[model samples]
Target: MSERVEWDDLPADLRSAVEARTGKVVAAEGIADGLNCSTALIIETAYNGPLFLKGVRRTDEPGMAALRCEERINATVGGIGGVSPAIRHRFDAGGWTALAFGCISGRHADLGPGSQDLAAVAATLRRTHDLPVPDFPLPQFADRLRTFLRPGEAQILQGSHLLHTDTNPHNIMIGDGGGEAYLVDWAMPAIGPAWVDPACTAVRLMECGQPPEDALAWLGQFASWRRARPSAIRAFVDATCRHWTATVGDKSAEPSNSRFRRLLECGRTETA
Candidate 1:
């Protein structure tokens, strides 16, 4: 996640534009969750309660493109019955681009042992897998992971299904007294097999205290998981181990890497 960029640090016109629609920004607090945004804030407005805002300099091509992708997806994803924050406003000018979403009044999900949020998180994952593929462009999941895997491994990961590949605990918000869960930050979305999100989430569940076997068992509720080929799942495990290796660099023994290795071993044991 990126460091917070204060509201006052925003370009004068950009801030003014946001305020015009949101109505006098009474209080702005920086959000430190998602990585792509240069500025992420939950602001209190004179007229409205709070609007979640994210922005980046227009010159930042990558940042702008990502925000734009999020903006486009929010409409479709939010329609899935509280699956995402609805975009309330959008600002493009003053050498900056920003989006404002209805603030989700809750904390990030806790994906640990016996947590109440597990069901809601699982429900959210089910909704995400059922999401309609938007007509706009999106990169394939295999393509994104291809750089980390050997040539043929990425193929089994491809599909027509819409995927929210980065649904770690932080990105899954548990609101309404922990009974509701919403997926945030569609910036890293992709088109892939239906099982992709669950597969990634299983490892995260492990990192958050679920044993490898327990994590794999948790995924059993999803039909997609049952339909997932053993070979494809194993390939994903291999690619993800490589992913963490690349991400952690020389720290091949990093805790995250170790988690994936355990997950790999667990899958192997199931098929053995």
Candidate 2:
């Protein structure tokens, strides 16, 4: 996420490799956002095109694996309904793995109450939820959340539905006219209940200053979320609270802790 590598940092051969596809790399700018990719960039080519690029050092197995998974998923769905950016090129050479994705022109989603972006975000997520799980191995949400989940709760969330686990506003792009919302960065896709994505988005909405009741009302549009077991929803809340509270240090926790307080109340309401 932080800026760890710049355009000039890539080896000459790797640069040339990218140039070959881009028709000469005329400009390169680093995009400092998420943490999974070692290098994130926006580059312009002599071909007069700008493309998004993400790369990982060859020696970083986990990083490379994440990118490869993204590449594969894009290969299958990136072209379908503009759900994600299409991969223009991908290659492994010069001790590096690079993927060039069609750069999207848009702004991050605004999850505030009554924001027009909400409808489009909701539609886009519905499309994402409907995508047929491509024939490939994906990690299970239950397994990922297992450590924090208490007895009986793990089983409650287990499902075959595909999930975009990371739906932070930064990752959701609202197109020029705000008619389209694209979910970018497929670094960590998981399989679980259909309600999982909706639940995650609800948290983001609240994080963006929307009240929990309004957030839940907005999310109620999703049938899966509406039909979800109250107990299951509570489990998701408890597990995520435990996970986030445990991971973030004290200084950063207070503000974040405040946000989840209302969400925790919403969770506990399920039990009451």
Candidate 3:
């Protein structure tokens, strides 16, 4: 019988393949919670560079398909110059496929209006939104909104666009690529009208201790950049905030599925 393998327990074959393709040994140090998967920081010397290795369980969750889809999306967007570069590594072992990506440098900070960092993120978001969705049957925004609302959130998100389901502070990597910041993590990307992304960001800012006024102003900047309707934006923003307040339990605690819960709720709202 074949031995069961966990993601953290790197297979020698996978490690060898990575070194053969990238021409370097990956001494991967584990990083904290990458949603349902595991992420490791692969360090290589001689300018071979570091990579973030993400793996998913093919059996336990159906959402693993989304992760695979994300790998496809990243591969397509890699040539576009600003997206995360996910290099697929061949793995003959336990269904644990991996992608070697360039480590995005710089810090992931709390977003604020007029902050060069936040502006860069907003700009990058616009760039992504402009990309052709290409017959992508994304989940409906209104339905998701309804699913997420507490009691009155539905009335607010009557119409909205797709959202970057996980826009929390840690995911927004601020890099000096071409003197700009870049957005990462497309695993749980949500399909909403538009405000969904900013609203998520606003809730993250609030969780990070920013005042409601400040979070709103920051979200306004995101709205202006994305050219989304104010009503829709406010609705999603309120939903995200309410969801955060409920699911987060402690304001300072890191939110686990607040993003997913928000997306599901909003989608439910749209379908209703």
Candidate 4:
């Protein structure tokens, strides 16, 4: 069962509505604290199942807009096989938008570092990418990359694909049934050049336990599918590390700085 959280922490209207629907609020607890949103594990009787409540943090107007976009994208992904388990409701009150979704039981998978988990995630990701972009504004990688790159950061945009932006294991759950894996945390999805998402995963997995060589091999498979040139992949990986490292320095995120460093060093050379 998912751990519960305090009802007082959620938006008033959202808590009321959810309580009305579920009959009672079991528990709401933080699952992942991120820049965009704070995910929580919520359980109630009405649904008779676990639910994930994603509370969009106050990140100024731009941050709010991105959070809304992520909600729309997740809803779209549902039309495909499944993406983050369909969102149950979106609560917007007092300028706060909280997204509630079904929570599948199971801890996020740990495929022993660089295991075939990459292949499994990649396959599911491809399915999500294949899902047609209808009316919603698809995330643009080229624009963000160009804007966020440092002076010497490499410009790598060879093949484009829908990316989850944050595909780390914390955001992916693998079921005990078999190779079932579900991607969560869509707050940072972007339609960008290939290898970026996988690279992010590769780095994080390497931190988990996967060897550099094994992680590199997984990246190689991702590159081949996306038709990304090796140089481009290397460049993207480097930029990804730089971006993450900068975040690690933030005072608010100091607690996670060590994990970020480990993520940055996974299969990474001092200079890519």
Score each candidate by Cα lDDT: 0.81, 0.81, 0.56, 0.61
lDDT of 4: 0.61
Q: After superposition, how far is residue 150 of candidate 4 from its true place, in Å?
A: 8.9
Per residue, candidate 4 scores C-alpha lDDT tens digits across 158-204 of 34467787776777877666766788767677776655666666667
Q: Candidate 1, which segments miss by more than 4 Å at Cα?
A: 1-3, 79-82, 264-272
- Over the stretch 43-69, how does candidate 2's per-residue lDDT look in tens digits? 988773988889998888989888988
Instruction: Give the alpha carbon lDDT tens digit for every residue of 1-272 in model 3.
Output: 11333433676666666666666654556666345454345446233566666655455364467566666666544544644554545343445566667666666754653455666666766666555552465555556656556666555554334355677666777765553656666766555555566666666666666666666566666543245544454556555555556666646333533432332222223222
Each prediction's TM-score against the native?
0.91, 0.90, 0.70, 0.74
lDDT of 1 at 125: 86
Give the CA lDDT, 0 to 100, for residue 176 in model 1: 72
Could you tell me the lDDT of residue 177 within candidate 3? 52
Query: What is the RMSD of candidate 1?
Result: 2.4
Per-residue alpha-carbon lDDT of model 1 for 32-101, expressed as tens digits? Answer: 7778988998899987789888888888888888898998888789743748989988898678889888
At residue 258, candidate 2 shows an lDDT of 54
In terms of TM-score, the best-performing candidate is 1
Q: After best superposition, candidate 4 residue 92: deviation in angstroms?
A: 3.3
